[model samples]
Target: TDLAAWAHQDVPFDRLVEALNPERSASRHPLFQVMLTVGQSLGSGPELGHLTTEFVVPELRIAKFDLTFGFEEHRTEDGGAAGFDICVEYATDLYDA
Candidate 1:
């Protein structure tokens, strides 16, 4: 997975956050700041509805989330923007005991 590879290959976390914006959203959350300083979301999404904005991986766990840009699975007639759906999904060795 790209994310795993990035960690293995030493890609900066900041770049990862920059590329982590939502594919389809009315507005974007300030995710880059959160993921950098703290490793989780503060859940400051709009007051009305929940937003699926951040992706979290703990420091002890390594993840390879198969996400890519420019691979939109659908398009709207109104010319709104969307992005890659995970052709492959996230995988980690951790399991519930």
Candidate 2:
């Protein structure tokens, strides 16, 4: 599917778990938040994804997503690249439904 289609799809929970690493659970990485803003924007039902607020050390070296929020870059005080560095596994809620 295309990027647009992919963005509107629901990602499975198992897939998200598999993407994270087993170690580094105690690291002090910044938290990443992925909200179902689009769905709510279109006056849909409750938030699609049931998010579990916790640290996730990803082991997968996947390419950056083409989403506006997920793929944008950030500059930190330490002169290091900073951005959404964790996996966002959630089901999509289409506004056109």
Candidate 3:
């Protein structure tokens, strides 16, 4: 696929969007309705001497696309795959919660 072949290319996203020149709309993204991202997990917060710490996720107040899915792979102490933290964001104007 052209996308796969060009994955390593250093093209800026705005440039690509400009080149495609899809119909402009205030209610939708220019080229895609959905997006997916996979990345390393956000590790636990720093350790305090003999005190406990918790990882807190802030609230999502905005949606960048119609739908966006994010997967973060967590790793064990010994570098093994632990689990995944998954999250989905959707435009409330377009879809019901």
Candidate 4:
């Protein structure tokens, strides 16, 4: 696999998008599938603390996720990192799977 497509340095976003392999996009990414499971767990926001869940993705990878959902609009130092927290659901024909 050419590592350039996944490298996020000074490369422009459009070129990176154009160079992505369909097979890799389809199921090569375990993190992506993990996020999908997390999104399914969290339907809406206005909650706090960490959410834990598990799932099995390709390559027989078992993912244990503990993601934080914050009701606060801004991130405090105590919160580690904070910003506009929202649950955004989107889709694209980027992956064949």
lDDT to native, each model: 0.38, 0.39, 0.88, 0.41
Lowest lDDT 10-residue stretch of candidate 2: 35-44
TM-score (C-alpha) between model 1 and the true structure: 0.18
By TM-score: ranked, best first: 3, 4, 2, 1
Q: Tell me which residue pairs clash in candidate 2.
A: 10-91
Q: Name the best candidate (by TM-score).
A: 3
Q: Name the runs in model 3 displaced over 4 angstroms.
A: 3-8, 42-60
Q: Write the residue-wise lDDT of candidate 1 on 1-97 in tens digits.
A: 9887766666576675567654544232344211211122232344545655553435533323322112224344554544333322223233322
Better candidate number, 2 or 3, judged by lDDT: 3
* Residues 45-80, model 3: lDDT tens digits: 679999988777688689989999999999999999
Between candidates 3 and 4, the lDDT winner: 3
On lDDT, the candidate that comes out on top is 3
**lDDT, residue 79, model 1:** 46
39 in model 4: Cα distance from truth in Å? 17
**Residue clash pairs of candidate 3:** none
How big is the RMSD of model 2? 18.4
